[model samples]
Target: MPDTEQLTTTTPNVQTDAPSLPNLEQESWQQLASAADSEADPFKTLVVATCTNTGAGARMVVLRQVDVIRKYLWFHTDARSEKVIQLEAFPTATLLFWDDKQQRQLRLVVETRLHTDDYVADDQWHTLGLGSRKIYLSERKPGSEQPAPYQGFPEQLGENLPTKEESEAGRKNFAVIECRTLSMEYLHLSRKGQTRALFQYEPESKQVWLAP
Candidate 1:
């Protein structure tokens, strides 16, 4: 249930503005930007679930970038990333984001493009801090078997990330994904109950507040 503030908005396109639409969009993007800049344990910061060939699915990845005006999102991966392989076979994916503090959930349906070339990959690689770049420097690719359950890198480097030169090995494996968001659904819980809305941005613009 929304606040008793009882503000209503009507947009020509959405058939209703309800003031809350812009409020929701603004707050949503602000929180999204914060999540993108998270400094702690960045893994699974934004999980994108994708269906690979044969109908298997997987999730858990970080959010690398966001273009609010353009409504596009990005994430980094290895050229050997399983998600990349899956996206190659099926370009559709769903991005799921939940913010506990706000009790908000965002679901985005997107079309994905993978870039493995040097120029594009280098652009993303240059932005990665030393700690993150170290993950890509492993001798074996991601998902590789461990001879003895290794720490994903040499023992001496345990919890100690490698230097720039050391991370160079990962440069060759860097991959960037561009996700054009097609639709965005938002859910927020309030004392009243729950408020749900759908914002569609592709093919045509659409917005709807549904009964929950």
Candidate 2:
């Protein structure tokens, strides 16, 4: 009789290469630009944190546009929303992005400027499709109390999109939030090791690696 031994296989830890401190700024901006262009990109949605009279507030918003050279990020929101008020009161905010597939996170310190009735808002409004514009047609402002469950837009539409003329009504409610990036902190998680870096764009330009 012969004896047999059992064998087991172990999976290797995943390792992600970290960008050099010098190149981190460029790479991060490139990623953000791509996210702004691609709807499926996880980074297309981010947490925008703002200061309130009492404390702090945070909400998820879609990434509308990115100017890599200018280091500006844009997102659309209701002109009458609470966030718009908060941002107007305190223009500084923190924009946070996380990509699960890449195991990466980006925290951006930004100064916000609201554009409600300017060419900037008009340009961004024109880019919205009917589906995206539909919400702006709501008679009630965002976060308004409802008798029951009210869809943001008019209930009569009932899943139907508004025409260009009909959608125009929403233009007054649409607002563009322009975020000027002051600094960005990048963090990458890997089984092998973690990487963290900071890139400052305002006050003074600087890049540095930090302890992860």
Encode model 1's per-residue lDDT on 1-212: one tens digit a residue: 87889788885333242357777777677666666777462322877888865776767778887888888888988787677789998999998887676677888999999887767677888899998887777667677776777565556788887888888878877889899989989987767467788889888998888765
- CA lDDT of 99 in candidate 1? 69
Best by lDDT: 2
lDDT of 1 at 43: 23
What lDDT does each candidate get? 0.78, 0.93
TM-score winner: 2
lDDT of 2 by residue, 105-180 (tens): 9999999999999999999999999999999999997888878988899988998999999999999999999999
Give the poorly placed runs of model 1, Cα more than 4 Å off: 1-19, 40-44
lDDT of 1: 0.78
TM-score of each candidate? 0.83, 0.91
